[model samples]
Target: MSHVHVPALASFLLAAGAAFGQAPIVGDIEGKEFRPFPIAVTELRLAPGAEAHKSAAQQLVKIVRADLELTGAFKVLDPKSFIDTDGLTQSTVRFPDWLNVGAAGLAKAQLKDEGSKLVVELHGFEVASAKEGLTKTVSGSKDDVRGLGHALADEIYRYFTGEPGVFRTRIAFVRKVQGEKHVFVTGIDGQGGGQVTKGGGLNLLPSFAPDGKSLVFTSYRLDNPDLYELALGDGSLKRVSSRPGLNTGGRISPDGGKIALTLSQDGNSEIYLLDRGGGLLKRLTSSWGIDTSPAWSPDGANIAFVSSRAGNPQLYVMGSSGGEPKRLTFQGTYNQTPAYSPRGTHLAFTARDERNVFDIFVLDLRTQKVARVTQDQGNNEEPSFAPNGRMLVFSTTRSGARQLVVSNLDGTKQTVITTGGEHSSPSWGPFVK
Candidate 1:
């Protein structure tokens, strides 16, 4: 039937006006979208005679506020008219000052210079309950203050959302520019992006180690798209597997103990598991047709993957220990890239309907009921669960290019999180810290 479901990622989108406006701070979707919980951020002051670092403190506050705003789950309140606590501390916060501004959550801090080291005190307060709160202290050199601000924002995120903050996490994706695709890594908010691969070869489908210290991707540097591991912090690339045929789509298990990927050295593409040391543990599936895109269950007891053994690619769940897989998708003509949620209960994948349109869908393992994640769109594929299981990162062809997009699980507040050219195959890393 020639069931080819891997379509180029393109999707519909809504306009974001406030995200483009300039204020003390700006959140991407404020009105008529997934508005983040209202929060206030104030710049803390330094000690007397520290006037030289006053500008530094102002920059640090904006840096922190901008981060939490990107989550698309927060509504960051501008501090322009809010009371300015030059030297704000937890005890010094005037709760009404933020409450009057309609801020449900507030952040106040102080930046101090302890000799050559700089220290920051950050706090998250809930005005309604006046009980949900957190205090964090980060110390580093002047250059590291920016990094610490991101860390502080992450802390506030966790305290309020119960979701592990992704403020400090990094995202690695492949981008196509001028007809050439290159791999790049950037911080969670799509900032500080840099090239990780330098070659005329076409590189794609780069997956990261759970720790994000390294990456495994398919690169055709020598005319062969083999899987290679590239270490970050340094621009070193190691070819992990270049089996005579195709080596692509590397996915590391959650435990960081094994990697499951597609291979065709045997003349047919199938799924195989490689141990942490790069030793082949076992072939996961061997069908006369194609079986690819293997995602490991959170417990490592089973694997959720896409197989065409049923005449069309469909979602299948097989024992991690190796056994015949049970197909999970029956209504769709094709389905692939089965991603397991971090909570270990649901599976999300790209399902293609008869109209040849693809959208994100979530299936609850307990009930086997499928729920569409993205509504009427151009095309939405490769849905990945955020750490909190409340959101996802996928590839969409909106804003005039194929780029990475992030949205809640229910597709309530969808947002395109990238500004780069044609990007796809976004793999969100686990909590790094």
Candidate 2:
């Protein structure tokens, strides 16, 4: 909020007192009352005598603040409330200054553009303990300085939350341009958005491999619905399944050993398992009704899918090896696009509420309770979880266009990830391995 200038300092001093405190960031958060941790992010300083990448420095801190706020667990204090802007050295930082502003945690960094890379020395502090929790130097190409900032945010997040952060992961979605749809990939924050497919046909349902190196989707390039895998490294396309009739709804397993998809070649749509190379491994569902949109659990022991067996499309979970299916949704007549969280506690999907409005909902697997993620917003659907399962990506029509939206798991906070395009069928990719 304020543009107070801070001199460059070598070391940061953290002060701890009992005046301000925050809830511990550990333990199970499911079904708990939401409480945001108060944190303050200081403007990053430029290293001594280093060429000032002013824009990069500002963007880096901005992104770090955004990444934390987007989690819905952090409340970033306004910069105007900061009382200490002087050079923060190990002995100069005053705990009372930050605690006065109601900040339980503080994050600071120094940026240096060293020709080939942008180097950053980042630090995290606890106000109550008056101690630094994280101090690390991270570097990245000048072209990807935002990534460096995200990496820093991840470290701070892990330091407090003891869990992995999703800032470095990516999301895949369908971006429509002039009636042509192509798969597009973007960072979790919507940076680096680029078309992954350039063919002259429709491409949809872009699902990433567990390794995050390739995307598998259904395409109409050959004038028939078929499955194809696109190598993200070299932009190479390989046809995975071109069987006669219908081939769609392809989802790769967590172990990368199999793919679960829908095949209507037998005059009836059913869920089927295929080897990584498209060979039919087994039939997962032989229901009389349409069964599609299969998603694998993190352990690869179960598959959550959509089925119309109960005379209405609903969510169902069955063993990956194929067995009696158990319905997982009863509150909605229409529930599809089930995405099991990697944390193994929730299943996010699109459900039509009683008002016939499509919204995103997350089912607590442990509690067997359904929580709505989107409400009163124009048709929000196709929920996909970030790698850490703390966030989700979906398409919303609330802004008058089918745009991509990123939100915390409960949907209390949301941010649009795309603008000026009709994007849908979003799938968050795994962390880069």
Candidate 3:
């Protein structure tokens, strides 16, 4: 599918600080406690000739609200509490009415049908000062209401937080179907996507290339745990590594030039580096104990992996070009699947606590401080960070069925993104272009 293009309709400066007369609405995401910024998203007003698009507009509003709420930074006020629902312009909006309902920000949009396309005029206002802070016009195919909604949500998030939203990003995971594990890709909300692997025996450990155009995973369709890269655009598959023994846990480097994976061809499971193709570049680890699940740092300077060289499977970090490994986790006896944040400031991995239950934890690289992300929530593992580094997607068993869950950094807000089938090994894709 072609990428959707969303352009601003006019040049409007955001006077958020001056309008609110307060600090930024969103504070440190890593902090232990936070008060969600209350924002009101009004129903999309139907233009004169767009009366037929009521359902589409409603769906778009729902998508936008869901995206904003999933960030754990914004609380979308209920529409029932809105007093001025017909206001789509600054002159019509009553700032005091919104402020009375505990809304600091307001979002209003108008939907229009342009024959060949659908155009939406989005307006954002600061409810405290009756000032407009954002104005955008998003257009797409009539069938792409979801994309239109996500684009608008992203604009609203950036206007306030100064960071790109992950609404348009994709996620990949392994889902069991007909007793075989297949790889699937979907939007962050786990909607409007389909299975990616076919004729699959068992596909596992799916990771995305930095470009967001391809996915690398371990597939046993050919009777061996070989590494394969599947192009997401054209459905083309290429075998990246097929050693005599295990070739699994393939993670493409952030630069998209190399792959770090586990190989057992040397009679021991060790981390190895390979070129974009199937050619071997270097053997990164020579430990007698198992070393696997290599994850690259955002800048491609280092890698984090699970190693048993310290007697128990624990997290370790090393230079990408072969260097002495440094242990990162001391409290957990079993740690695996290390995933570095996009900012290179933290590492999220799965650790088994004293009760032998697996959960997610984050380690601050700067302070050497460890924080738990999930606790007593059934077994959660294989955490993959979103491109923004503020959220994570992992497999969880808390829903009675193994499913995929997206969680904020502190585990306070977690929403299951997949259901019905046993899912695991979720890898959140990079931000879409």
User: Each candidate: what lDDT?
Assistant: 0.73, 0.81, 0.85
- Per-candidate clash tally: 5, 7, 0
Which parts of model 3 are misplaced by more than 4 Å?
A: 1-24
User: Which candidate leads the pack in TM-score?
Assistant: 3
Candidate 2 lDDT by residue in tens digits, 1-433: 1111111100000000011132234323323444678899998888875546888988888998999988876888899888756554555678888888999888888887777988888888888878886788899998887788889888777766656678888889998977889999888778886998986889988899999999999999989999999999999999999988778989888889999999998888988999999999998888889999999999999999999999999999999989999999888688899998775667888888778889887776766766677788899999988876667899999989899999876666899988897999998888755
lDDT of 1 at 244: 76
TM-score of 2: 0.91
Kindly give the stretch of ten consecutive residues in candidate 1 with the minimal lDDT sum.
6-15
What does the lDDT come to for candidate 1? 0.73
- Alpha-carbon lDDT of model 3: 0.85
The residue-by-residue lDDT of candidate 1 on 1-433, one tens digit each, is 1232111111010111112232212222222343557877766767665667887787778778877766666777867768765234456567776677898887777677788877877776777655435777877677766677777777776666554567667777888867788888877667776788887879888777877788888889888878888888688888777777877788877678888888898989988888766678898888888988888887788988888888998999999867999988888788988888775777889988767877888776766766676766678888776654556788887556777877765566677878856888887766666
After superposition on all C-alphas, the RMSD of every candidate to the true structure, in Å, is: 7.4, 8.0, 7.0
Model 3 TM-score, 2 decimals? 0.93
Candidate 1 is scored at a TM of: 0.85
In candidate 2, position 335 carries an lDDT of: 88
